[model samples]
Target chain A: MQKIEAVIQPSKLDAVKDALLEVGIEGMTILEARGHGRQKGHTEFYRGREYTVDLLPKIKLEMVVPDELVEKAVQAIVSSARTGKIGDGKIFLSKIDEAIRIRNDERGASAL
Target chain B: MQKIEAVIQPSKLDAVKDALLEVGIEGMTILEARGHGRQKGHTEFYRGREYTVDLLPKIKLEMVVPDELVEKAVQAIVSSARTGKIGDGKIFLSKIDEAIRIRNDERGASAL
Candidate 1:
């Protein structure tokens, strides 16, 4: 399975969540984070607020899906999370060696 | 070194934390999250409330540990976080190409 971690604007969270759910991706985790990208140390825009600092508040959505669902998931995130703005955030993809459902000890895809 | 991301029940946070600290593994990023497991859309148990929505509260513990501490850290988390019930979460391990601490530009393990 592949792990998809997308750091996106907090304002776009609702839209992105709905989009992911619509794509048949039911399981996901959300996190509140602060960071900067290429536009580091510049004024950052978020939820109608502006901050002239190196780091800006970001919402991170994380999930693990079967290999085949990676592209669909990424597209869903990009389309919903995008604002055509620099602080729209980035999506990271990585390999998950194993995933175990803590409750039942199920592993791999089923676990995801 | 490996980046360990564990999404577990919020109630287990304290125990998991102490376990890692006891093992000399400190410095972890904690995020408030909402997610669902195999059951997908259903009732969720969080901090003392009923979540009848599609998602449930989860605590995501993330940290990068030196290769030598990976096993010890994982064990500490697993032992403390498992509840033997459905809401218990999963652990993901991934390769981290590089880690840079911005303050002094410390790289690799130092960054972690």
Candidate 2:
């Protein structure tokens, strides 16, 4: 199995989720993160003082799918998340050795 | 080496942290999440309306560990996280090709 992790703009989360669901991908985990990527830091005014905010708010979506679905899932995310902007985000693919459902001991793709 | 990701109940966060610390696994990332598992959710009244909330608040803990520490780390989490309840949560192990610390150029297990 492959685990697809996408670090995306917060504003693009709903679109990405809906896109994945449209492709028959239902189970997913979402997390809010602070990312310092290639995008340069920008100065912000806080309490009348300028502060450089290096880390920007990001949303991370994670899901484990059968090997066959990896490409489709990636395409779904790319199509829905792209904004022609610097912080459009990136997707990472990783190999998963096993998956076990904690509820009933279901394993492998079925557990996913 | 492996990456250990645990989806646990919010109330069990402290115990899991202490358990991991006792085993010398200090670096971890925590994310707030909503999970829908075998544990049936309850109903709540919001704005004077009843809602069947199938998804419950959860805490996701993630960390990369050396190969030798994988077993030990998993044991620490299981021992501390188990509450003999339906929603005790689960742990997932995945292979990591590389890990690079964003702050520096450090790589591999050291970056962890």
Candidate 3:
């Protein structure tokens, strides 16, 4: 199985979640995160001493699916999370080695 | 330190939270994630065909700190999240280029 992770704008969370659901993707994980890309961090003045903020607020979404569905899932997220802006965020794909259900003690794919 | 993320069992979340709090790591974000790895998912009986599920439920945690605090933070997570089990999940560390606070428009490290 593959894991699809996206760091996006908080306001875009609902739309992305809905888009995934529309594609028959039921389960997903979302978290509030902070990061920066080409836009870098922004400048701020606090008590007159200019301070730099390197971490920007972002929403992290994680989902797992069979290997065959990886590409489709990525596209689903890209289209759903896109805002045509610079701080739109990024998506990552990774390999999962195993999975288990803590509640029922189920293992492998069945645990999903 | 850095961005310390862990994909761990749901049952272990509270314990981890308490541990981090003990160390003065106050702010964090958590999400419900799913994945399958070495265990490869499991078999289940649905109607007649034994369908296999590959995704497993997990909690994703993200945090940011100064580069100097990386090791201490990683240790905090390792000790807090350890259960001596096979499906304990994984942790990843990466470099972040910048950060910004949308509310006040702060940038760089101060955003953390």
* TM-score of every model versus the real structure: 0.78, 0.68, 0.49
Name the better of 1 and 3 by DockQ: 1
TM-score of 1: 0.78
Rounded to one decimal, what is candidate 1's iRMSD?
1.8
Model 3's CAPRI class? incorrect
Candidate with the larger lDDT of 1 and 2: 1
What is the C-alpha local distance difference test score of each model?
Answer: 0.83, 0.77, 0.66
Residue-level lDDT of model 3, residues B28-108, one tens digit each, is 898775543343345533235443334455678888766776656666767777766655666655555677778999877
By descending TM-score, how would the candidates be arranged?
Answer: 1, 2, 3
Report DockQ per prediction, comma-separated.
0.57, 0.33, 0.07
Residue lDDT tens for model 3, A7-103 = 8877777787767766657556556666655644555333455434556667787776667777877787889889796667788887654444433
Query: In model 2, where do residues sit more than 4 Å from their true spots?
Result: A39-53, B15-29, B35-56, B66-88, B96-112
Most lDDT-accurate candidate: 1
Q: Candidate 1: which pairs clash? A: none
The C-alpha RMSD of each candidate to the native structure, in angstroms, is 3.6, 5.6, 12.3
**Candidate 1 residues B28-103, lDDT tens each?**
9998887755565567766678885556888889999898998788788888988786677888877888998888
TM-score of chain A of 2: 0.88
lDDT at A15, model 1: 90
C-alpha lDDT of candidate 2 relative to the true structure: 0.77
